[model samples]
Target: MKEISDSTIVDVHARRIFDGCARPSLEVVVTTKSARVCAAPSYSDPRSSGKYEIRHFPNGGVQGSIDLINSIIRERLIGMKADSQEEIDGLFLDIDGTEGFENIGGNTAEATSMAVAKAAAASLGLPLYEYASLNREIGVPHQMPNIIGGGATMGDEGWKGRTPDIQDHIILAVGCQSTYEEMLCVSDVFHRTGILLQEADPNFTGGRDEEYCWLPGLDDVTCLDVLKQACDEVADARGVAFRLGLDVGAADLWDEEKGVYVYLKEGIVRTPDEHATYLASLIDHYNLFYIEDSFFEDHVELYVEQMQQYGNRVLVSGDDLLAGNLQRLEKMAGRCAINAAVIKLNMAGTVTRTRKFVEMCKKNGFSTIGSCRTYDSPDDTMADLIVAWGCNAYKCGSPAGGEHAAKYNRYIRIDKKLGEIPTFATFPGVKP
Candidate 1:
């Protein structure tokens, strides 16, 4: 790789673009000595977003983020070395001068940071993953594709304000021999699951949530049942094994004033203990391989209880709970009893911070799962990130759409170049 120097950078630019969800998002371009690379920021649903997160470009929208990047950020970063990711990211923090990126915007900083990384990788004639990490023996991550969607990602037009509170119903392709096989398994399950839902409800309307899961007028439990049936059928037919997972994004359903988890569709509310018990029952009943945000983000006690009860049987992962923050992860390291952490790049503001969180997870024996935002672009950056960091799993929505398939396609290319068979992780409920 080429050494980074002051002359490595030429210019920096930021602009507004529409993401896959047709929402305003920031795209940053970094011009280097040899290449120009562009990066688009990801978006998380506000309900499930971390309390500490910046206000999505200060409510200035894409234009505000673009203004900061093109002016102040550009002035500061114009002559810096693209390879100095930590220093470049530090400049973002220094300029923002706020803890949650309140000034410049987390999305803006992240887009610029990511674009710089890509530029540096290109200048060195290396892939982004390789430039980020020198290790070449990184394991190919298993796919955790969403099979059902609800909560914030669901549109109100379909179900007339009655949607499952749970955010995502995911499936882990546990028994696949390679990433290619895992992709096939997930694709089959995704389509078959949709077909099953359509058959079950002639009034399904074929409406899809953000992740493209069929938005049927079903309760949470019914959704799980449908997912289980579909996975079972697909596994049996394909001669492969699969396990279920859930990203409840429970913070979205928490009724702050009522102090309970409100299941509007079921017309029920559960206190913290009641909610934990319900989740435990679901995990046991379905033999769930993974469960994320089973409790609200700040509900540390409930997280600990679930981990104590089912940590040995499942990956009690934290997405909203940790929110890609090292401080939160450290605070909950041994206390919360979580077995896994979801690592999202934009949530941490920069690649340096994201990698730091990943290292923290490793040091504490927490398996890291690289995750994409709720509103992702066609960029497959997270795909390379997980492989480079050797995360245990990668979640980039369902296997159908081009936006989702881009990550899978990138992984296939990476796997081929590596000239080694991709290995799958050994988790609970998978046959040996």
Candidate 2:
């Protein structure tokens, strides 16, 4: 067993069919066959509107920017040795130079690049993580069980037809138990909504072919009980430090009257502001790790107050605050507006931009977390980024979308490669 030679690159075409989206794809692995690789490998999910997303190409011919992914990628990838992390990264840089930021806005370059990595790993007979600088001591990542309600504001184009920027939050709770099992269950409210959850805009319902998810109605007391039970089970099985999270999604939510943010809206979930204290209390009670869109977007004062009070209890993350843009996050940070921010790929428009956003947030003492939209598939490219770029946490959704499953699989691969990581993964001196 020896280091893979940089002179050799492997090209292998692959196939993936998940959540009803099936197509033939290509993956290129660049590494030497002689590398004493521990494992040569490896590695999901979604979009917001019609403008984003790379469709599966079963016939091998797809339209849009995806067609820009040339078979030339195979040419540049072949004969590369996976001797070190720097070497592989350098390879990517060189390929990308000719390719040049081709994989932005759900571009096809993403699909092609992902496939190439997989092929390169297999060519070397080394696990993808091993050759790709994977750490083999990190145990699989753990996510807390908190329901997320996805509410979208409907109506209007500009300010004229623009209905309120609010959404109906239907809680979709994630479950992880002592048996190392993580399941996502919805409340009775979503159950009642039935097909309505799937019918977001009705006129513009994306992922029309995928299964719809929503929260069924339930009393706050019942929802609380369910949440507590799930929390208890997850904490006991995994470590309490594993983490819990929530996303209210404030872009569709707003508040000009209450002077509060969008999280206080009624008929969504948790009974508006009535449960703010209760929710905060629970967060404190359970040592919750992260909270997103808690008080709506742009409610700087509300967030300031939450941070002042709960700063020592949990991490209050921001999504709409920065809308996945670093410049916005920096502005918000300068104003002392948030503790954490979400990294949405489309929001940044490209992987390059997204990386900059993550870097900027980290510079400002913020944790960068990866996330997914409701509409998704078996594409784990983002999941791959989460590991490669080292996100604090990832919200790919309740294992429903094969996208979730795909990401979960990638995480498992990471854990297998890296081993178990130190339990010292907390906010640390941040007082969160």
Candidate 3:
């Protein structure tokens, strides 16, 4: 067995920083006897988030979270072992003493927990991912980059009196052997998709949403068609295969009061079953490799039905449905018909719990995808997390933007260090 270091933490510090959207967020640094590490929590768009999640930070903004971390959390954690991740995070739970981290703040707990892990990895002179897991077969996750945008991320400004209910239209480079190749394939598709959009609409302006998803004046189905045509063109030109994915974020369209999904742009309403059938048809029509949150978080039965019907053909995934919570994940484990779960570390409030959730998913034969927030800081921690724990897929928006590029750059660095091209996951068995 390899000997691990037992470095004791000497200090903990907290500060306020701005995320991608200039929203207030908390950042923390943990110092061990030999090294130090820092981290910050990312935020999701309000419309795309789960209904049951705790307050992102305390109501007082970043200052409140920093105050709690400095005054209450620091002293308790300073003398603990940095290498003991579970113990450090357990102390966070005890200090907060509230479900969903309503007291000390989820963002604070997440920043502190991740900082300690990074400090421990630094102390051991190992990469963050290597320190986090014993598995050496950590392959590169398939990259899903958003090519089109709609719903909450776009708001009402760019829709031109029409609202597309779907959240994101993404692309998958399924047949690429390495991260570099996958990136090239997606980049080509992104540019080609843009050219096609510009040609189709004479008044089209080059505008994008927060995640760099193209803001085109087209309905959901029309956007999918455009993306598919772009993918076909890119594949033929580059000699690589690609597929389409959707982050439907169905909760954004669900009407809790009326018990129907209101597609304001299409001018139609759908019950759970009608919505499921419509989504299934879309999957078949576009040959979608991944579909996320086809139903709202509370609609477990509907999710199960979709999973049963299409899990074999597509990655029936949950983002809003799971929201990185252990109890919710456990509820969907065997009972719900999901084949994959999106793991966003901060949403779970700690790296320890996030790993536990990934383990739970693996045990239940579900693939795990490490995902980033739409409103994120310029931190590459998620890049390390995905590689370190060996997730099956990764989603961090387009290759543009500093926040998104940070993740892609980290993966490129990792690939360079390995000196060997890493294998990528193939969904739907990569049709001929």
- Which lDDT tens digits does candidate 3 get at residues 1-432? 233545788889998888877777768888888897888888655666787666577767679889988988899987788888888889988988886988876778888888988998898888887788666667677788888887777754445236356888988886676788888889889888888888865666877888877877777898898888999998898898887889998888899999999887788899988998999889999988889988888889988888778777688888888878878888888685688888898788888988888888877778777888888888888888888777887888776778888898888788766657776543322231
- Model 1 error, position 73 (Å): 1.0
Q: In angstroms, how far off is 221's CA in candidate 3?
A: 0.8
Q: Provide the RMSD of all predictions against the true structure, rounded to 1 decimal.
A: 2.1, 8.5, 2.2
Model 1 per-residue lDDT tens digits across residues 35-112? 989888886557447665555576476798888888888999887888888899998889988868877777888888
Best by TM-score: 1
lDDT of 2 by residue, 1-432 (tens): 365444254442323322323433233223344321111111122222221122222223333223333354445545654333344444443544532233322323444444444444555665444433354232233432224223442211222112212222223223322112333232222232333333433432322122233232333233334444544554554444233445544434444565443332233333345435655775666555566776645557767777777766566778767666555677778877677777765455444556667768767777666776544455566665655555666665444445556666676555544544322123422432
- TM-score, cand. 2: 0.59
Off by over 4 Å in 1: 1-7, 156-161, 425-432
Candidate 3: C-alpha lDDT: 0.81
Please give the CA lDDT of all the candidate structures: 0.80, 0.45, 0.81
Clashes of 3: 1
TM-score of every candidate relative to the true structure: 0.95, 0.59, 0.94
